[model samples]
Target chain A: GAGVSQSPRYKVAKRGQDVALRCDPISGHVSLFWYQQALGQGPEFLTYFQNEAQLDKSGLPSDRFFAERPEGSVSTLKIQRTQQEDSAVYLCASSLTGGLGNTIYFGEGSWLTVV
Target chain B: AQSVTQLDSHVSVSEGTPVLLRCNYSSSYSPSLFWYVQHPNKGLQLLLKYTSAATLVKGINGFEAEFKKSETSFHLTKPSAHMSDAAEYFCVVSEDTGGFKTIFGAGTRLFVKA
Candidate 1:
């Protein structure tokens, strides 16, 4: 693909429902990141992956949010028991290098609405 | 610890006039700074980055930022504003502190008036 591709551009979930968002990063990109962006706010870091290794998950808001990149190519972010506060855009980004100061390419993001 | 602060929540500029967006950062080590623009309903696009290489960095769309270590600021500037430049701008700081994490500011909304 030309850039990072995210699935389910928009999703509306009921309270207590579980929702999964998928992200396909650029070809052979070594680093993948997940972020949450609320309305009128900048994107906040959620998790990061270096290949198949889950090196960092410090930014995940709570235990209900889980992200995995098992094969190191595609990643999924699953949220359990969605709350109204969870309604926001989830963005996926990828970078060629796994270090500070590296440029990251972002996807269009998946807009999630919890009713 | 490293963080970024965007001074203004909103800035309005007339087309063809100069644009200035203020940003300040705090870092314990040499930091890498970036400016990203996000249009309505669109993904963020990198405008420019300032590493340790050069103090002045030029980015896409006639946008540029200067790194001032003494002031702890990396303010974005453009000679002339355009209507198409209306968007949200974010200031980001990255440092290899606890881990490789990128911190984003609250973001400033730029409104260009024709």
Candidate 2:
């Protein structure tokens, strides 16, 4: 079965540019999450959505970071006016249920470089 | 707030030697603990999880972790190391504080020597 899918495994953008990263969660998954990981560090939470409703966006670093899951299955993280400090890997994860009883799976991640 | 701490930033072991990666968590509620492994160029894979059911949890690829509430630890261990086990390991924790939120610890990079 397909776990989770992310597009454009690598991306390089000029500073102040805008970029959008896409994620395709597994079929029937009710929960989706996004995280940012810098080199040599663990993943940091970005946002989460349960079905079409986004319940958490507190982890988003700044207003420049925006995410949307209009259809509930596919989600997008958009960054406006990117900065060099935003260089990191964006990871997408999903689970059958967001409860503590279910396990979450992750995608290969889209590595972004801001120059 | 919930958080996890991976004790070692890195650990090296020879092939066939015992492997251990330690993690400690802080949560206000009964926490769900998980261990995930990420190989180079690959996505994060679930190794095991403990959801307050059992103290000892076993995962894929011959990995296991013990959830000790007394010491607030969920340490992953393997009886023997394989060269292919070299990768980064992350200890994750989820807590339901009004809403469920998961947090990841600083990863532990395992170097398996042949």
Candidate 3:
């Protein structure tokens, strides 16, 4: 793909139903990131991966929110026991390097609606 | 902790008038700064970045920003506004925590009036 790709552009889940969001970063990009954007707000960092290593997950809201990049190219963000508050647009970005001054490209995002 | 504050939630300007979006940042280390624009129902696009090499950074669409370290500000400016320039803007600060971690401001919505 020319840029980062994400699956399920929109998702609607019943309260307490689990959902999984997928991200496919740009080819050979060493850094991948996940962010959550509430309506009328900027994207908030959720987690970061350096290749296959999950370097940071500090921004994940709760224990039910988990992310993994097993092969370093594709990543998944899984939410267990979904809540209404979890409704937001989930964005994925990729950078050539996870260092200072690197530019990151973002995907259109997966819009989640938890009822 | 590194954070950025966008001074205005919404800014309105005439199509031909100048544009100014104010931002202030707080960081414990030398930071990397950026501006990203989001069109309605579209993904974010990078406008510009400050990487310490220059105090004045020029971005696409004739937009630019000056990094004022003493003032803790990085304000985006354009000589004239265009109707198409209406969008949401975000001010971001990235600091190295093992690797670079980025924090984004709430966002400023720009409205260009005809």
Candidate 4:
């Protein structure tokens, strides 16, 4: 079975530009999550979606960050006016259920660089 | 708030030697613990998890962790290290304070020497 996957493995953008990263979760997965990982640091939660309803967006750092999963499978994280501080890897993960203890699988992540 | 701490930023061991990765967690409520491994240029992979079922948890590739509620610790250990074990290890904690949220530690880099 195919695990979670992201598109455009690498992206470079100038500060103040807008960028979108896509994620295709595993088939039949009901839960999706987004995380941001800075160099030499662990991933930090960005948002979470259960099916099409976003259950959590508390981890999003600021208003410039946004995410959506309209069809309940694929998701996209969009950043408006990208900042130099946003240069990091954006990771996507999915799980079978919305349970707190459910095992979440991750994608290779989209590496974004803001200059 | 829930958080996880990985004591060592890096650990190096010779092949066939024992491997230990220490992790401690702090949570207001009972938490679900997990260990994830990330090879260079790869995604994170689940090694094991403790969901309040057992104190001693076993995982893949000869790995295991003991959950101590008193100490608030869930340290990962392997009897023998393999060259392939060189990677970054993260200790994670899941809590349902308001909704399901997972937190990750700083990660420990494991270097296996021949």
Q: What is every candidate's C-alpha DockQ against the true complex, given to 2 decimals?
A: 0.80, 0.81, 0.79, 0.86
Recovered native contacts in candidate 3, as a fraction?
0.69
Looking at model 1, residue B49 earns an lDDT score of 96
How many steric overlaps are in each model, in order?
Answer: 0, 0, 0, 0
Alpha carbon deviation, residue A100, candidate 2 (Å): 1.5
Query: Which ten contiguous residues of candidate 2 chain B have the minimum total lDDT?
Result: B93-102
Pairwise DockQ winner, candidates 2 and 4:
4
Q: Indicate the docking level reached by candidate 4.
A: high
Q: Which parts of model 1 have CA positions greater than 4 angstroms off?
A: none
TM-score of chain B of each: 0.98, 0.98, 0.98, 0.98
Write candidate 1's Cα lDDT for A2-112 as tens digits: 999998999999999999999999999999999999998999999999998888899999999999999999999999999999999999999998877889999999999
In CAPRI terms, where does candidate 2 land?
high
Please state the error at residue B47 of candidate 1 in Å: 0.4
Q: Which of the two candidates, 2 or 3, achieves a greater TM-score against the reference?
A: 3
What are the RMSD figures for all models against the true structure?
A: 0.8, 0.9, 0.7, 0.9
State in Å the error of residue A68, model 3.
Answer: 0.4
Query: Candidate 1 has which clashing residue pairs, if any?
Result: none
lDDT head-to-head 1 vs 2, winner: 1
In candidate 4 the C-alpha lDDT for residue B13 amounts to: 99
Candidate 1: Cα lDDT at B109: 98
